[model samples]
Target: MEAKQLNIGDNVKKFRELKGFTREQMADYLNLSVSAYGNIERNKTDLTVSRIQQIAEILEVDLAQTLNFDASQVFNITHNEVIQGMHSKVENHNHPDEYKEKYIKMMENEIARLKKLAGEA
Candidate 1:
């Protein structure tokens, strides 16, 4: 399905509703007076970068998603699950026994150095 096009007010309102926040509640969270925040949601004011960041955090969205309102683009650019899975697989590789031994030894040495530096050796 084609993603719905959302303007700034649409994004703001959608996210607020998704989070179950009314304009007054969201304004309280933003430390803005209700009228000021209402202006933002009504598209009468531009969102500053800091405000956008704050709204993204409040909406539990990424900065890009708040600014662009492109849900697909947001997911594509910021998906962490795939990357984390790949990293986990690589870290658990059943490599040559010799390689595993070397990796362990390296880690041990690093830990020993850290302990010594911290006077905890």
Candidate 2:
């Protein structure tokens, strides 16, 4: 089965609504036209990494929280091994515990990077 595409823009919009910020308010904060901000929330325009971080801060959310990265994508993963005739192919060699550790490490590193960027801004 194919994994469904997750839109980061939707997540950002949801968090914005949760924070009670209207499009106009957010656009004003970002110094962008309402149309531009609307496009972003609607996933019409590509947003830069810094812009995403700014939005996350505006909504008082962690950048990682806004991103919602999955273990499979962030870390190399395989579900199982495939046996075809005499040939065997390993899907993912990492154990569940290993994935967990990598997940935690990745999250921590990302959070730290964002914090550093925020400090510089």
Candidate maximizing TM-score: 2
Per-residue accuracy of model 2 over 6-111 as CA lDDT, tens digit each: 5777777655543445788778778899999999878888878898888766655667756773334423332333322324333334365654565576568767
Q: Which stretches of candidate 1 lie above 4 Å from their native place?
A: 1-6, 71-121
lDDT of 1 at 107: 55
Q: After superposition, how far is residue 100 of candidate 2 from its true place, in Å?
A: 29
Which residue pairs of candidate 1 clash? none
Consecutive 10-residue window with the lowest summed lDDT within model 1: 77-86
Give the best candidate by lDDT.
2
Model 2 regions lying over 4 Å from their true place: 1-4, 69-121
Model 1 lDDT per residue over 1-121, tens place: 9986546776777556434456876776777899999888888887778888877766667877776655343222211121221222111223344434544565587679989999998
Error of 1 at 31 (Å): 1.0
